[model samples]
Target: MTNSKNTGLVPPSAFALGGDLNVTRIGYGAMRLADGPERPADPAAAAIWRPPADRAAALDVLRAAVEAGVNLIDTADAYALGANEELVAEALHPYAEGVAVATKIGVLRPAPDEWVPLGHPAYLRQQAELALRRLKVDRLDLLYLHRLDPAYPIAEQVGTLRRLQEEGKVRHIGLSEVTVDQVREARETAPIAAVQNLYNLATRGHEAVVDYAAEHGIAFVPFFPIAMGAHAGPDGPVAEVARQIGATPAQTALAWLLRRSDTIVPIPGTSSAAHLKENLAALELALSDEQFAALSALGQDEAADGVAA
Candidate 1:
C-alpha cells in the first residue's frame, strides 16, 4: 500500500490513538453499497436518490481503497439494515491484518427506507450482537452509538457499551452526534476511542467536540467531509481554490479537512470508483497557508450562508 508521502501528494500527518491503530487520514464509508429496496441489479438505479452506478463496481471501489492504504472503513447497522454489514464482511472477510472496521448501532429500521432512533440498552445490546453476527467478527474493533436517545439515560447507553467491552464483544466505544458534555458523561462510564459527528466546511456546529477530542487524544471522525451541492458554484470558494490547485472543488474541500487536524478521519462515501479515486487524491493536494485561510474564511463568511468548519 502507498503511504501519502510515496504518492507525491500532500501527506496527512499521522495520529496515534486507541492503542496501535495507524489509519490513513482519509477513510471510506460503505453506506452507498446497498441496492435500495428492490436490491436492483444496477447500482445507479439502486441509488436513485443519488447518482446511478454499478453495485459490483462499487464493491470493486472498496477493494481498490483497501489496496490504496485506507485501513479504516466506517458503516452502520441501519444502513440497508444488515445488508451493508454483510457486504463489508464479504468484501474484506478474510480480513487484512491491520484494517479497522468501525460500525454503529442505535438507529432502527422498522420498514424499508425508514430509520428511527432506538438506543435503549436492550436494543443496543441486541443490535451489537446482530452486527457481530453479520460482520462475522468476535470483537468489534470500534463500535459507535449511532445516536443518543433522549428517552433513555445517556449513562444507561454508555453502561451497556461498557458491559460489552467487559464481555469482549467490543474493543473500543464511541459516540456520534453528541455534545461535549455528553462525551464527558460517557467517558466516566468507559474510555471513548473516538467521536463521529456531522462536521464539514459548511456544518461545524461540532467544533467544540472536535477541540475537546483533540485535547484528550481521542479520534474525531467527520462524517460529511464534503458538503452536498453547490460547492462548485460560480463564486464558491471551493471552486476558486480548485482552480488555483488544478484539482476539483470537492478535492480542495477534502484537502482542507486533512489539514484541519491530525485526529480527523474523513469518511466520504461514494458508489462510483471514479469519484472514490478523486476523493482519495485530495490527500495529496496540499493547500498553502493562504489557501487554508481563504477556505476557513469562507466557512465564516455570512454570505457563504453559515457553512461551518
Candidate 2:
C-alpha cells in the first residue's frame, strides 16, 4: 500500500457529510491541540483536560492542515475547557471555502483531568450556544453529542440537538461512543450524519457501529485512530504489516481503517506538523486483499487461538 496522491495532508477523495457538506475522508482531529507537553496514559484522556497548549504552534498546526488540503477539522468545547474552540476560531474563523469544521457538546470538565456528561436539555442548549460563540461560526458544520448521558434518555439528547438545528445554529448532528442501536434511535429523533468512536487496529469494540455507518451512508469518524499501543512493538503484527507495506506502524493502522470501509474517516491528532503529514499519507495506502485481511486480524488472532484452545 502507498499514499502517492498525498495533497498536503488531505486525501485525494471527499465524503458528502449528510449528503450535503463535502470533506476529505482523511480529516484532522484537534484534540491534541489541547494537549500540553505530556502524553497521557490513554489518547482519549488527552482531550479531557490538560494545560493550555502553546498558542502560536497550535494556530500554526491548524493553518498547516488547511494549507495541506485537509478540510475536515474536528474539535469540541470540552477540549481544554473551551480554549480549544477559541484557538480554532482565532486561527481559522474566516474559514476557507470547502472546509467543514465539526465540534461536540454534552460533556463538561469540572476540574483538571475530570470529565462528566450533562445531557439535560438546558445544559446541551447552553453548550451549543457557547460552542457557536467560541467557533465564531454562524452555524456548526456538524455538532456531535460527545457522550451519552446516563441520566437523560437518548431521545431527549437528540431532540435537544434537533431544536438547535431548527434554530439554525447547527447544520448537522452526530454522536460519539455510540452503539448501532443508539445510532438508529438517534435518527428517529434527528438526522445523524456521523458517529465518532474509539477504533483502531487493536481496539475494535465498535465493529457493528462501524459497519452500520457504512451501510447507512453515515460518515464513521474514528477518534484515537492511531492508538496501536501493544501493536506498535517491533515484533508485533502491525510492525510486520508496516514492514511489508513500506509504511510506519501508525500509517499502517490508519490505512487499514481506510481500507476497512469507504465511509470511515480517520482523524489522527498530533501537535507536530510532521506527525500530521504522516497520518494524512495513509490515504494513499491501498492494501491488497490478502494484506488487508492479515492486518484486519492483527489483534484478533490471539482471541481466535484462545477460543480454539
Question: Among these predicted structures, which one has the highest TM-score?
Answer: 2
Pairs that collide in candidate 2 are: 2-284, 3-284
Task: Kindly report which residue pairs in candidate 1 clash with one another.
Answer: 9-284, 10-284, 44-52, 44-53, 202-308
Per-structure clash totals for the candidates: 5, 2
Cα lDDT, all candidates: 0.79, 0.84
- TM-score for all models, in order of appearance: 0.86, 0.90
Worst 10-residue lDDT window for candidate 1 reads 1-10
- Candidate 1 lDDT, 9-31, residue by residue in tens: 46465555475678777889887
> In model 2, where do residues sit more than 4 Å from their true spots?
1-12, 35-53, 301-309
**Tens-digit per-residue lDDT, 5-24, candidate 2:** 32223233678889998888
